[model samples]
Target: METSQITDLKRILANSLEGIEDPIERSRSDFCFYLENVVHDEGPHALTDYIQLADFHREIADTLMDDKTSFLLVEAFRGSGKSSLASVAWPAYLASLNPSLRFALISKTDDQAITQLTGIEAILRSAEHQRIFGDLVPHRQYYNFRAPWSEQEKVIVRPKFSRFPTFLAAGVESSLVVGKRFDCLVADDVIDLTSSFSPTTRNRIKHWFYQVLLPTRDQRWSKVVVIGTPWVADDLYDSIAKEMAGKSFFKHIRIPAIQTEQTDHGPIYKSAWPEVFPLTNLNRIKSEGHFAFQNQYMLERYDVTQSILKKEWLKLIQQDYIPKELTILQGIDPNAGRVTGKTGDMLALATVGIDADRQAYLLDLVYIKGDIQEQLLHITDHITRWNPKDIASEIEATQAHFKNYLEAKLKETLGLDITIRGITSKNVPKPIRLRAMFDAFIAGKVLVAAHVNWETGDLEPLPSLLPFVEEWISYSANAPHDDALDAVDIALSSVLEYGGRLAALTIPSEAIIIKDRENLEKEEEMSEEDLELADLLEKYEKNMTGTSVLANPSRFFQRRINFRGLNL
Candidate 1:
């Protein structure tokens, strides 16, 4: 604030750097002290109470310097100050210690690497840098003394007094210049979400890392450090982690958002910096959903271990269980978005039966895309075969229109009378509905056959299994083609009526009925047309799980890709 205070602060800073002549030794002795006392305001971090910062990032530096750990992988949360600490300050500090230490810093792109190196070079040129670490110019004339120093973005500070590089920055794909070996490789932001999304790009980047980047390191004594947060479960970091865990050469350090503890003041949860991330903010983050908080802050895979609708959580039934007091229902999510292929919705419907014990089994699934006549034929075939007590369809604007059309078509063509009720909600989102599908599965109330690929009755289930289980295994928030999944969710939600809670625990459950045609006809008073339609369906009910029908979007794309590649 005043001249006197500034002088006193400088005096204190000088005193703090007292016996630390070598920068590497200083960083080793106290990284936080060096950052606060010497290289102030030069790093990316604005706030510098680095007590917890040291807990997370200092181990990375210590491992790189000591040479005990050859590979250091740090999966830090966003806004955790890892960039400033790992890529910028720590490398600069290491350079001052080993002026002959050849350092290579890389990012996702060459421009990014250059920009980060530029910041590091600026830090080295600061007044405090000159005062504590000494000026770039060693002799009388400043320009002449500094003539040997190269300040380009690609490479910074080729030692005038020595023969090693301060740091060489490049993109992952870029080639390292000849005539030198880099002993330290600091890869920052190497694999971001965008770059890691494509399988081709992901493979290319990983191939570069193994084939190209690894060769640039000095074979004698090189140490690598990866600095970034985890995005997906199988990103670059995860791949390295798979190979390097518990090995003698590599080490990993992960810092979570907050830690809950019990004290004299009762149970309390607090982040490393409450000013940066308060409890209320964390609750808001959690409200974004399970995977959002876990992936970003906790460096986890959005509950891949035990997500809602997991395979292990589901109860399976191989044999048919026809019982009384049954609530036979069908959830119809008819193609609201044009059934016109390439950019349209597939008609996804699920026929489920809940018994007296509340153990619901998926009887059949109808997933297809066709014209209005074909759609009516396919849907009516399932209704005739299954004889579900009630049918629930999402009453969105377009779907209501489709439902009206479906009713008119059924009455006209088949002379069959049917009513498909509308299921409505105000502001409920898709993910919420998807999440709500989990409660019943987790409660062990839902069941599926080993083979749900084809639309078949319980008595004569098809063995041509194109397992839907695989879809659940790979599904995440970013997955495509969720038509069949949405239909199943609607069906479960309707019967369970769990109100998004565990239905078995909270509410009295509904029962399912498996009615034959004779009983169904008597109950609903089927006319002559209905009986004719039933006979036609019974005669023609083959396995309708054709590849061209209502399958997942991913399945369709995959089939297309495979078809194009086939030589036969």
Candidate 2:
């Protein structure tokens, strides 16, 4: 703070740069070095002492300095100091290299943008910075309006070759930089929680980003960097990720607070910043609320309230506890196209069994990425092992051929006649059907087999059901993929329907049942009135059979069906 101490600090910084040839150029080329030596707010201790530079920070620095990367999107967890590295230090280093460089810093609000601008101002005016970069802003004219040093904008003491200011800070809502172009643009935390949840706000921010902010790039040597924590799916960050995917000049980096690995014991959680946020500390944060922890720390994108299923609600029973007389049914959701890798779209098959009490147990789940033939082979293998009594499949109008092919394959391979019941999802939305199927789960009527270590009293998810469980817990109406959910929904819904118990719970308003063509031919000859009666009788027979239905005498009368002396 005093002049004498400032002189000593400058002298020490000068002595440190004495041996290096073109130390200023090194500061511009090596971002990490610049961040360490020239950009320090701590008094005596180095920046590393206050904030440890993790490997992801180094990667971010490399990305900022790389010439080939023109667009970089960083989604690091909270407290990662991404703003300091990308917004403050990187801009200061660039301005030190070229005094005429025009840089724009944007945030969610003007106050936040000004706060970040103050950091860059402090670093540029520091003793070490002036000693190396030679007085970027004249000390005497710092407050003078003609020199333009303020919270919103600052022009360095350089030749006025361009019309744009050397540094500008504004919010995403500001129109100050309508026609101005910049050498570097940084959009930081442009979408907060409020904006992330509102579609109109997210759309407005997205439009401003593409229509206004992005056009300010100089297009010759400009670099654009967007950095923030993920708030939700299809937020501005997700939109940017979708836009920049697979592009040569774009790079996206995501670093979560904890990394998980499955071991023989169980899952092990490793902290990304172990020195700062240890596993114990992260777990403590998780205890606060998993939804917040998942969004802010783990970088997952789903709201707990909006999620259709909860992991805690899924009952896990021991494998040997299953009833021997349970009727098993397999449901398959085949991928329309062939895929070879684990990351691609998958063919999902879920096997569910209904016990005498009409409780559904998720027996087995399989997700494979392959052609239809390969998918059929997996289905056959599961059926051979489980020996399910019935098989149901979701057959889109475009994929009707799969039903015939699968039936023929089953007859030929097993030497048995099995008709594949087709489920048509024509007018109904997937979320609606899934919600209807999970009604049983909410009522404590659905269960899953668990892998238990009885000696340790520890339990792990069944290996085959792990993927389905993950999808189930994270499922939202707008989830990108729902193959596993579809398979489970079809299987569970079919089991409930076959047991004549679907009407007891909330039935999917849309009729998803599709009979085979041969069964349809039998009803075509009936008269108009007879056909309506037959249809009702067929639905009643299919949806009403077990003692559970017989116990509910009022339910039969509620449907206005006359069953006076039919079977009772």
Question: Which candidate comes out best when scored by lDDT?
Answer: 2
Q: What global local distance difference test value does model 1 have?
A: 0.63
lDDT of 2 by residue, 1-568 (tens): 9999999999999999888677777765677877766765344555544335778889999999898999999999998889988998888878878888899999988889998889888888878787778777755744365467778988877755556788899998799889898999999988877677667888999999999989889977899999999986789999999988999999999999998889999998788889778888887676444456777899988442466468775656556555778888888887755422223367899998887667677778989887767887898899888888778888785345677777888899887688878888765545534655555554445666665542322344689988888887878766666888888887875764578563232111111111222344466563555445444544554555423322442332222223322442
Provide the overall lDDT of each model, using Cα atoms, as 2-decimal numbers. 0.63, 0.74
Which 10-residue window of candidate 2 scores lowest in summed lDDT? Answer: 506-515
Off by over 4 Å in 1: 1-29, 41-54, 137-165, 176-180, 260-269, 302-345, 348-481, 484-568
Judge candidate 2 at residue 244 and give its lDDT: 84
Show where candidate 2 strays beyond 4 Å: 1-28, 41-50, 141-146, 261-268, 303-568
lDDT of 2: 0.74
